[model samples]
Target: GLGPEECMAVNPRLVYGRMTGWGQSGPLAPRAGHDTNYAAVSGALWGCSPADARPVSPFAVLGDIGGGAMYLMTGLLSGIVQARATGRGTVVDAAIVDGSAHMLNLMLSARQSGLVADVRGQSIHDSAPFYDTYVCADGHYVTVGAIEPQFYTLLLQVLGLAEDPDFTGSQWDKAAWPVRRARLAALFLAQPRAHWQALLEPTDACFGVVLSPVEAAQHPHMRARDVYSERQGVLQAAPAPRFDGAAYEPGEACAPGAHTQSVMEGLGQSGARAVWRQR
Candidate 1:
C-alpha cells in the first residue's frame, strides 16, 4: 500500500489504488483474509441461502472481485479524473469489507420500503414461490421470477394453473405462499424439462434453466454472444462490455521481466537494461 503521503511526495498526479479485505485505517486492516471472511463481516453472506440451511459457500466473486477489484478500479478512475483537474494525487483505499457493506445498502433500502422482509425466505426474491427454483420430472431444475401481477398471471396460464383458486389472490399474501408453492411444485414435477420449456420459455415470465458450469458455455445464447474463447488451451470467458460491437482480445499473462527493458528505458534508466540482458 502506498501511504499516500510518501507516494504523493514524488508524483503529485499519482492515482494509487489499494485493495484489501479490511480498510486501511480500520482495526482489522493489517489482518489477512479471503472472500468468505470479508463477506462475513460485510453482511453480504446474510440471506444468501435458505433459512433452514447455512449460507452456501459462494465463489470468490462477491468479495474479491465485486467488492475489492471493482471498487479499486472505480476509485482509481475517479482519482485519475480528479487529479487531472486539481494537479494533486489521490490515494484510494478500496476495501472489500467496506465496499461489500456499502453494497448492502440497496437491500436495506428495500427493507425500509417494505419490499423486502426482515426475515429470510419471505421476500419476493429471497424465497417466494414466484421467484424460486422448481424441479422438473427429468430431475433437472428451472427457475422462475414472475414477480409482477401480469407476468405471474401469464406464468400460471402457461403452467395450466389459470383456474386454481390459490393463485387468484394478492402475491404478497404471506399465508397463501406455501399452498401456492406446493401446487407449483407438483405441476413443475409432472413434466420433463423440455415440456415446460416449450410452454413457459417463450413468455415474459422471467424463466431460466439452472445450468451447470460445463453446460453454461454450450447454451444457445452463450454461443450467440461469443461469451467464451480458448486461449493457451484453456477456455475462458471473453472480456465483457464490448466496444465497437466486439470484445477486446485479451492477451496472455506475461511472465515477470517481460517488459523490464522497455519500462527501464521509459524511466530514463536505459543503462540498467544491460544488467538484466547479461543474465
Candidate 2:
C-alpha cells in the first residue's frame, strides 16, 4: 500500500494526514477496532455511564468524529501553515486513542479540584441530585446541572423545596445526596416533562428537557437559527460556526466518486482515469 513516505517523496511539501483507532506503531495498531474500542482504552468511556451500568457508547461522536476527524483536520491545517513557512511537510498521525485521552484534560483538572472522584457515581456530575436526569410523569426526561449554590437555590425554589430541611444543608454533602436524589426524582415523577419545562426553563436553574433529533429541529431556538435543514427529503444539520453571522447554504449531496474525473484532471493525472475505469 502507498504510505506517507512514498507520498512525501513525490511532494516534499505535502501534508500527510493519517487516522487510526490506535496508532501507526503501537502494539494494537494492526488490530481491527472502532469508536468504542478506542474510547474504552482512552478512559473516556468509563465515566459516561452511571455506576454499576454498562458504559454506553456515544455512537461515533466520541472517537470517530471528535477524536479522529477533528484532530486530523487540526493537524493538517497546522502542517499546512508550517510547511508553507519552512518549505517542508510533516505527517499527522491522528490516533483516536490519543485524541480521546487528550479530551479528558478538563476532567483531570476537575479531579484535582475535588469536583470529580476516582470512584464512579461519586462525582458531582454523576452523583449529585441536582445534576442528573429525572424521569417525568409522562415517562419523558429532564436534566438539571445546578452545581453552583445560586443555581441550586433557584432549582430548589422553583421545585418548592427551598425551605425543606433535607435540602437546606450543604449542597456538596455526599451523605445527603442519595436521599436528595430520591426526593427530587419523586417530585419530578409527579409532573409531566412539559410542566417542569414551563416552570423551570425560564429560570437560571440550568434545566433542559431531553429532546430527540426531530424534536430538536422543531425547537424554537433551533428553528430561529435554522440549525437543521432539509434537502431532497433528507434532514441534515446546517454548517456550523457561521461567518460574520451569515448563514451558509449547503450544496446538494452527490454520489460517491461523483467528482473523481474532475479531481484527477485538476491534479494533472487525467491518464489515471483509464486505469481507474479498468477496475
Candidate 3:
C-alpha cells in the first residue's frame, strides 16, 4: 500500500487512495486481516447467519468488493475531479472495515422503523415464514420473500394456507412466526422442488428456486437477459448494472505481471522494471 502522505508529497495533485482491511490510522492499521475479520467488526457477518448457526461470510461481497474496491474507486474518481479544479489532491482512506459497517446503516435504519431486529434469524428478512429459504423433497432449496401483505397472502394461498387462522390474521405478529414457519417448512418438504415450482413459479407470490451456478446460467430469465457468458471456455457472470441499457464486454483476464513491461514503458520507467526484477 502507498503511504498516503508520502505519495501526496511526490505528486501534490495525485489522488492517493489506500486500500486496507482497516483504515490507515486505526489501531488495527498495522495488523493483517481477511474478509471475515473485516465483516465481523462491521456487524455485516452477524446478520447473515441463522439464529443458532454461525455467521456466513457471503464470500467477498461485504468486504473486498463492496467495502474496499468499490469505495476506493468512488473516492478516487471524485478526488480526481476535485483535484483538477483546485490543483490540490486528497487522500482517500478506503477501509473494508469502515465500508462494511457503513452498509449496515441500511438495516439499522430498518430497525428504527420496527421492520428489523438486531438479532439474526429474528429479523423479518432472515427467518420469517415467508422470507427465508426452505428445503424441498428433492433436497434442493428455494427462497421466498413475500414481505408485503398482499404478497404474503398470495404465498400462503399458493401453499394452501391462506385460510389458516394462525397464519392469515397475524402476519406481522412475532409470536406466531415459529409455528407458521414450521408448518410452511413441512409443506415445502413434502414434495420435490419440482412440484412446488409447477404450482408457484408463475404466480405473483415472489417465488424463485435457489439455483446453483450451472443451473442459474440455464434458467430462462438468465438465458433471456444474457446474465452469464462464456470466456475462454469458462462460464461466469456478465458485468452488471449495464450502462445506458447496453451490455459491454469486459476485458479478458491476464497473468498478474503480464503488463509490467508495457506499464513501465508508459511511465517512462522502462529500465526500472529490470532493476526491480533483479532485486
Candidate 4:
C-alpha cells in the first residue's frame, strides 16, 4: 500500500528497495525532475565546477544510484538481517536528500574545520591540478593522481622529468603544485594515452587512461575478471554481492497479471479466472 502520496508501505525488506532522488516526501519530493535537478536541491550540485559554465552532468549515478536506490537496497538488506535476529520487521524510509547529505559527511567535516572554503573547486583535492584529468594527443584523456609525495615522485620519474630541478625540490608544498601540474599537463598532452599507460601501468605512478563508456565494458582488466556478460541479446549487469557458498540467479520477467491469481488466492480473495469463466 502507498503511504501519504509519497511514501509506500511494503515489506520492510521491499520498502528498502524503492529508489528516488528527492526521496519519498520532503518539500521538493513531489516536484518532477531529473538527477541533476534532484542533486542540486540536496546540496550535491552547488558550484560543482569552475565558476564559468553550467554544471556537468555526471548522469543519474549520484542521485539515483548513490543516494537513492543503492542506499535503500543496503538499508533493506540490513533491516532484513536485523528482523531475522529480532523477529520484528520495520519500515525503511530511504530519502535521497538525507542520503545525499550523509554522503557529504567528509566534506562537512572539512567545512567545519575551516579547511574547505565555502567555494567549489577551491580545496586541495578539488582545485589542485596535481590530481586532475588532462587531455592527450589521441583526443582521449588521462588522469594524474600524484596526490602523495611518493606517487608524485613516481609520476615525475615516469615522465622522464626526474632530472628537472622542480621535480624534487618543492613537491607537495602547495605553491609548487601549480607549476608541477602545468608541467605534467603539458607532458601528458604530448603523448597518447596508450603510450603513458604502457610506461606507468607497471610503476607506482597512479596514472590511467580516461576511457569512454564503451571502452570500459571491453577493457582488458574488466574482461579478465568477467565483470559483465550478455544474455538473450541483452546486456545485463552481473549480480552483485555474490552469495556465500550459494549460487544466484536473476528472476525472470513476468507480465503484470501473471501472478494476479496466486496473489489474490494468498490474500484470501475469491476471483479465480476459471470460476469466472464458468459463470
Candidate 5:
C-alpha cells in the first residue's frame, strides 16, 4: 500500500488513477491509438451497423468515457469513500478494452441463448427498420423509434397515415417495414420540419428532429435552461449534473505548467524560483 504523497507528490488522500486502451505494459500499450483504434481491436466495434455499409465508430463515448473515464471515476469515488471512512489510498487502473468487452456481457448472453443471429446485418438489433433514422423535408432528418405497436400506431397517427392499411397490424414484420418506411418518408417530405415538430412534440410519439450541433446549442429549451456558456470567446460546455447549492466556474484553456507553482506550494515542495536558481 503506497502513500498518496509517494504517488502524487502531495498529501491528497489521492486515489491514483490510470486509464488506457491496451492497458499498462501490454504489447499494444506503447503503440499509439485513438478510441476508434481501440474499439476496432476490441470485439465491441464489430457488427454495430449494416454488413454492406461502413461500420459505425460508436463514437468516443464507448472507449474513452464510457469504458475508461467512467470506470476510473467509479473506482476513485469508491476509494475516496473508503479513505474517508478508514484513511487509506488506492490505485485504479481503468483499461478501455476490459471495460469495452465487459459492456458486451448482455449481448454475449443473448448470442449464447440463440436469440441473437450469428450474421451481423441479419440480426434483429441491426436489421430492424423501426428503430432507425428517416429523411425529412428541408434536407433534414428525424429519428423514429416506434419499436412497440402502440408507439408505432402513434407515429402513424402523427404522420396522418391512420388510413394507410399497409402500416397497421403486426409490428415485427420485417418485409413490410421497407414499404411503410417509404410511405412515411414521402409523407414526411410533404411538410416542413416545423409542421412535424408542432404536431409531434405534444404527443407520446417517439420521434425527434435531428438537429445539428450548432442548432442544438441555440435551441430555445436549451438556451432557457442555460445549458451552455461562452467564455474567453470560446463556447465551452457547462459543468454537468447541477446541484441545488453548488456553484461552477466557466471552463477555460489551461496552459501547460500553469499550476506548477501553486501545486508545489500546496505540496510544501521547493518553489519555482528555487528550482530555477538551482538549475
Candidate 6:
C-alpha cells in the first residue's frame, strides 16, 4: 500500500488522508475488520439497541460514514487551509475507532451531569416512556421524543392522558417508567400509526412516524424540498447543505474507470496512457 511519506515526498503541499478501521498504527491496525468491529471497539455500539438485545449495527452510518468519511473530510479541508498558509502539507490519520469514540463526547458529558446513565436500560434516552418508539395496531411504528417537561405534558394532553392518574406524577420518575411505557404501548397499539401521526405530529409532542426510504422520498416535506430524486429507477439523495439557497442537480452516474484517462491527463501525468492501458 502507498504511504503518506511517499506522497508527501513528491508533493509537499499535498494533504494526504488515510482512513482505516483500526488506523495506520496499533496492534489491530493490520487486522481486517468492518464498520461493526470498529464501532464495537470504540464503545459507540454499546449504547445502541435494547438492553436485552445484542447491539444493533447501524447500517454503516455510525462507523463508516459518520466516523470515517466525515472526519477525513474535515481533516483534509483543515490540512489544505494550513498548507496554504504554511506552504507545507500534513497527513490526516482518520481511524473509525478514534472518530467513533470522539462522537460519544456528548453522551459522556450528559453522563457527567447525571442526566444520562451508564446502564443500558436506565438512561433517559433508552428507558423513558416519552422518548421511545411504539408499535401501532397495523404493526407500523411511531417515535416520540418528548424529553422536555413541556413536551411531555403536551404529549399527554394530545393523547388525552393529562387527566389520567397514571401519568400525573413527575415526568422523570424512573420507578414509574415501566408501567407508563406499558400503558403508552397499549394506547398506541389500539390505533394505527396514521392515527397517532394525525393526533400528535402537528403538536409539540416531538412525534414522528417511522418511514422506509421509499416512503421518506414521497413525504410532503421531502417532496417540497426535492430532497430525493430518481434516475434510471434508482433513488438518490440530493446534494445537501445548499449554498446561496441554490438547489443543485446531481450529474448522471458513469461506468467505472470511464474518466481515468482524462483525469490523469488533466494532472499532466506523462504516464497517463500507461495508466489507461492498465485500467
Best-fitting candidate, measured by TM-score? Answer: 6
- The sequence of per-residue lDDT tens digits that candidate 1 reaches over residues 62-174 is 88888888899999999999988999768899999988888888888888878788777877666688988889999999999998888988888887778879988888787
TM-score of each: 0.87, 0.93, 0.89, 0.77, 0.79, 0.94
Roughly what TM-score does model 4 have, to 2 decimal places?
0.77
List, residue by residue over 1-279, the lDDT tens digit for candidate 6: 358888888889999999999998999999999999999999999988878889988853899998999999999999999999999999999999999999999989989877688889888778889999899999999999998889998999989999998999999888999999999999999999889988887899899999888898998888998888898778888977799988788777767878887788798885877855876
lDDT of each: 0.83, 0.91, 0.85, 0.70, 0.73, 0.90
User: lDDT winner among the candidates?
Assistant: 2
- Cα lDDT tens digits for candidate 5, 1-279: 354347655655667877888887678888888787777677788866666787778744688877778877888899899779877767777888878788878878878765467777655566656666666677787767776778878877877777778867576777786677677778778777777778886787887778865676787776766766776667765676679944465657677777777888787875665785576
User: What TM-score quantifies how close candidate 5 is to the native fold?
Assistant: 0.79
Better candidate number, 1 or 2, judged by lDDT: 2
Candidate ranking under lDDT, highest first, comes to 2, 6, 3, 1, 5, 4
At residue 176, candidate 4 shows an lDDT of 69
Clashing pairs in 4: none
Question: How do the residues 1-279 of candidate 3 rate in per-residue lDDT, one tens digit apiece?
Answer: 357677888889999887889888878999999988998987778877778887888854789999888889989999999999999999898999988888888888989987788666778777688888999998998889898989988998888887888686678888888988898888899998888888889998999998888898999988888888777877778887798988766567666888988988999997978887997
**Candidate 1 Cα misplacement greater than 4 A, ranges:** 251-279
What TM-score should be assigned to candidate 6?
A: 0.94
Candidate 4 deviant stretches above 4 angstroms: 1-18, 47-52, 110-115, 243-279
Model 4, 65-106: lDDT tens per residue?
A: 777777788888887887788765556677777677678789
The weakest ten consecutive residues by lDDT in model 6 span 270-279
Q: Which model, 4 or 6, shows the larger TM-score? A: 6
Angstrom error at residue 212, model 5: 2.4
